[model samples]
Target chain A: MRSKASPVSDRSKGQAGWGLKSAAWFGVLYLNLPILFIILYGFTTDDASYSFPPPGLTTQWFAVTWARADFWEALWLSVQVAFASMLIAMVLGTFAAAAMYRFKFFGKEAVTLLILLPIALPGIVTGISLRSAFSLGDVPFSYFTIVLGHATFCIVVVYNNAIARLRRSSPALIEASMDLGADTFQTFRHVILPNLATALLAGGMLAFALSFDEIIVTTFTAGQQETLPIWMFGELSRPRQRPVTNVAAIFVMIITFVPILAAYYLTRDTDDVAGSGK
Target chain B: MTTTGAARPRSLSNSFSTFLYQRPRLVLALLLVPPLLWLGIIYLGSLFTLLAQSFFSIDDFTAQTIYEPTLATYARLFTATNLSIIFRTLAMASVVTVISGIIAFPLAYYIARFASGRMKALFYVAVMLPLWSNYLVRVYAWKLILAKEGAIHWSINSLGLGPVLDWILTLPVVEGSSLSTSYIGTTLTFVYIWLPFMVLPIQAALERVPRSLLEASSDLGARPNETFRKVIFPLAIPGIAAGSIFTFSLTLGDYIIPQLIGSSRPFIGQAVYQFQGTAGDIPMAAAFAMVPIVIMAIYLAIAKRLGAFDAL
Candidate 1:
């Protein structure tokens, strides 16, 4: 009987059995192969076409990418858009989350639902709608339009994190600050801000990463502006310097990956970030 | 209590803070209004306007939009070509969703039940890192891998399986296409890109299933297989539902993968993009966009009923 209970405790252990582990390994490998292949092909000397084992390898593609003015402009634009959208999302999403968490108001559920809708709906739906609205309003397609499109979804990411953190932190903390002579701004600046600092950071990073890699929404809203991903899309189909594009792809992988890793570390212990979902 | 505060006047910001603190409702209103207006009015307003545009028709001769409210744009949707695009997209999305679900479940189950904390975190990274990486690059990589002169065929030839590779390429639906140039490649890439969505939700659901329940079933003289069938599988359905939502919706909305990897025929996303960008037909694009919106709305409603929201 004692032995049976012990086995049950070990039921969920890593060494539980081999079949489960092998199946899980296959799943992980399948997910990663494409990414790994991109990195591998980035080093290939065959620029005209991809071959499984490269005829040769060289470091020239990276240098070629470095010398491209268009790549730099696209990268810079993506950074600006990512930062702008992250700032907007952090401010608006944090405010909404803090307000919704602290006070119960009418139509609060509706407000939350509304925030979620942009991300919840298909990107094409959000994309065309914004494009239609822009054209209808006679707003020119520009950088501002792209930021607005990215911000719609970015706000949801920040709100999810901020609201989750706010819900978990006690109301007594805020009340006590006011009780101790801290005014509203001080209470928020001290108690609320500290409580929210990591979530906000996590949220902002995730939002930045999202905005950086965003395509569908940006496609409709970007007008003639080409963010890095948009540039990658065009270049893939009509690629002149193919390996340079792969090198640019490698660059994108690095840019988006760093923020995502940072966000993951910041929020790993808490399931508050938008895509964590569980 | 400050030395300069014999009878100091409060700063404007401090006074304002005090005032705001005194009225929580007012504070909430101030905090809430900006985001609400941004999302509600700006976003939903744009959406409503889009829906309105979908009902209008475009004038071909004038190259202008006719603003009168009508169902003329939607009427264009049932044209044989448009319907084929819609059906192709629907079939691909379902195929991707089902394939991803089947692959993800056992993997998620293993991570949820069998792995240690460190191993689980590693698996989470494995699942999420690709999702965070560039979407286009992944598709491009698959395009190369499935190319006629690419890795899969190369491997097949080296292994002395030359005829088998040719046979696959010559298969009826793929006669004019290789792996990278057909609907099959599109489905495979879609599944690859969206697999994390399936894995994470299912993992979350699996983790929530209690060991005690499994133990109870087995203690009652049930076999492990019986315990799993009766208890474990049913509990994980919502997670699978939640995951399917992402895979299905993403596949439906995606234009890039289809355009990059497949042949000339357009999916809903590509058609919408082309109509709006190339043809300068916003009304038609808006109408095409509505297909996914209507499908997703219905799908989400069903998902909510299946307890998917709880998992999310």
Candidate 2:
């Protein structure tokens, strides 16, 4: 029985190794294929509708996308929303992080949980709740409400980054500054702010990217205002402007790719920062 | 400890220093106030109002009238059809979570264990690139692939196995034959969309497993399988839980994927969309929204019990 079990275990180990490799390759291809297709189709001049392998290749759609005013309007709206959301998220998240990190206050855990709750809950719930809240309060659904909704979730991203950074920073630095006769504002400016700079920037970048691509919450909050995602949604449902939808998607890809890549790098070094806390 | 004239000024400064050390509290409050108020007023406030709206009956199918309180919407939600919708949504979410977890584990393992600096960065970028793309565009891209004359069918036809394909295609359960707009498509899309969320957290958790632990296990004559099962898996469970919460909750609340791919069948998300958008029954929509919230609350409670919330 022992001999039989040993051989079976050996055989299973070999199978597991091969299985892991195959799965890894398959997973990589699955993720990359749609992105590759999107990039490839951007150059295709399929006027009627999009096909996987276009019969002809041309940059005409790119020209058409460039010349379109609606595209610009949607892109502008997206930028406005993203920027507004990021600003609000950074300020609120920074303060929240600072409060949670520095102070021993009542309801500190509850406050942190509340802040994180919006993110942990599905976007749909957030959207629905916001929609209901706006209607209940008789608040008009507009750009401001959209900004508010996006910022709710975006704050979580910023807070995660900020709090992580704050935890990593040594308390001795602040104590040293105080002993050296620096004021709170001076210490913040010279020490705390500089230490938090990379985290804040990374958080802001991630917030911007998230807000830029956000559709679910925007759908609930933006009554008439059309962000790029909303515009793309409308375009896709109505088949007349299918290629335009592809064009808008390509634009989204370009806008989001750089910042998201940077965020990944920023977060990849998470262990180093986390270790610093100890 | 001196309280004389010279010591008085030093004490005053000491008090000032203490005040300065804790000034972040006031700053935090000031910073947190606007966003917190925004959430309180716009998010939680709306949720309460929505719940209230659900109790009030719609009068004459026009402006919702608060004439009488009833549980009609809740009753409607419990109907066999709506129950099926709820079940389907939950089932799809479960499947997506499990499948994405399975697919993500190895990739995450590879990144965390085998890959180093540049390769890690490249792989990380590859994983997240899809997330940055327009959600609608990604759905539409799938539409192009899944359509009748799309890539899948084209590839099959081009291989000169057209007859064999046709025979398989003629099968009742084949996607083109009345099954295209089924749970399969919706589940596939959910898996694709939420895979990254699962990957990142699991990878992060796997990376946290101490190298010394693995070395110690191997030194003790434990094989790779034993090391992973005994040491790595336990540490990574919290991440797996976080990833599951993300994938499951997101898929549950998503109306767009099912609307785009799933046939005329209504998932909870689409039911809410219809209740609010098409049917104009805001109260019913709000009630439907609670389905996912309840599920998530339960999930969070469980996750908290498992210490997953700390990792977040």
Candidate 3:
């Protein structure tokens, strides 16, 4: 859609110099080298050290990680937290988007700012604030606290995607539904939901990915409870657990990678909406 | 789409929907209240509590927080050692933001202008994967890569550039036993971690730039460099600023990378964590936490003035 806007500029396409391409590749290498090393070390035969050019490769760590009860527990806890957070975010984010889209209100800018604050501010502030808030309220640090912490930021992810998609979708679709004598529930169920499905799915997946791998906020909110990232942190502190930690890192990468990829594809063609560009 | 039976009698849900339809204000309230209760009351209330806590002082003998408001904690924050931690974190955040912008620009430009169709999606996913990869693992990977007997050291030695690395490591402020123990290593890790945050926004902003604008620039007697300077660069500023917000604030508040990989000197985050966790001085930690908040508030104000939030 963009490239077709001006054919003259299209002539200049593919003219990116070798320097720029190599620079981009360098950026790619910079991003992935550490990740590659994580995978490499996961298969490393030596367990005690990160000696480069590992003496040999083996599958021992995978078996060891599989047998570890704590690893499984952490992974389960992370999954539950991510799912809960994502669900809360999806519900509240959708409501926020609907209100903002359908009505005019004073202090809307302030509300938007408030919504964005959790993510816009540093994680440390959110962590410590939530920690203090819970303690002051005499609330114990538990699964619920971690989910609450995760949901605050996760809401922003879903809200951004939902609002963007709402803006892209035409209001006429709802008007038409109403004109055809559909009630609010029917219009929402039949019209608004279909338009929002992919956006919500993408947002939910991103939210899950975020809550799954989150460490900083989890540190404050989780009391004696290990999420996968926190588990990885503990493992990193122990030299003997290096290989097993790397294997767990591989598990995290695969878990998050799938959702992120799904989100990318779900949102890639969002311009092609059911009632857009009308 | 499935059409409902028009002859069917209206159900309870339909009548309730009708009631809501007649009251748009009610509908709006219903839509807004839940999210507002969470964000406004819960999240903002917590923040307010933290700010209020910062104003209170801790008792030395009892090790308990005195409810009375005072600036003593803020005063404690300015002691020489504490001030150094503040400065160190600010310095690192600034440097990381700058370096991330430099490295992210060309790659973002390539993705924005050159890559198309499947290639574009591939590049986009490639950049995004690292961001979603476990944050702890990425930092730990860098720790291994920068360790004394790590991959970088081994590679440098294999290339017979061992002396060069050693020489580089021995430089004034950056000097340490190895890369992993220096500010340089921490800075590098910070850049790698935040690079994707910098790239994505720039790419989005650049993608939104209509090709016709570039055609107009070229047709208006502007050279390639002039067109880039006057048009492309100006359009990308919002994105760069937005990206800097993440890179700067994240680095400023992060305690983990420094804890695992850098010099033993504490950053603001480590200070906050330790003051609150080990020292059990909540007042001190709250006061220290305000440093990044204050810095970011100023940073965000400027970025907002530059229309960075639109890019975000």
Instruction: Report fnat in order of the candidates.
Output: 0.77, 0.52, 0.80
Question: Residues A9-59, candidate 3, lDDT per residue (tens digit)?
Answer: 667774788999999989988998788888999999888877889999999
Could you give candidate 2's per-residue lDDT for residues B1-312 as a string of tens digits?
Answer: 653433455566556655755776666676667757866766667667777777765655565655357887778778888889899888888889999999998988877776655877788777877765566667766666655556655776788876776666565533343223555667667888888889888888888886767778989999888988999888888888888988988898898888777667777888888888877778778778888988888988898777676555
Which residue pairs clash in candidate 3? Answer: none
- Give TM per candidate: 0.93, 0.89, 0.96
> Candidate 3 — what's its lDDT?
0.92
**Judged by lDDT against the true structure, how good is candidate 2?**
0.77
**Candidate achieving higher lDDT, 1 or 3:** 3
**DockQ of model 2 vs. true complex:** 0.40
lDDT over C-alpha atoms for residue A249 of model 1:
86
Error of 2 at A231 (Å): 0.9
Q: Write the per-residue lDDT of candidate 1 for residues B1-312, one digit (tens) a residue.
A: 753422457888778876776888888888988998898877999999999998889997997999898888899888999999999889889999999998898899988887776888898899989877777878888988988778887888899998886787778766545678876777788988999999999999988997888878978999878978889999999999999999999999999888888777889999999999889998899899999999998999999999998998
Candidate DockQ values, in order, are 0.61, 0.40, 0.72
Ranked by lDDT from best down, the candidates are 3, 1, 2
Output per-candidate TM-scores for chain A, rounded to 2 decimals: 0.90, 0.87, 0.95
Give the winner by lDDT: 3
Deviation in Å, model 2, residue A247 alpha carbon: 1.5
**Candidate 1's residue-wise lDDT over A163-218, tens digit each?**
88887777777777777767677887898887689989989998999999899899
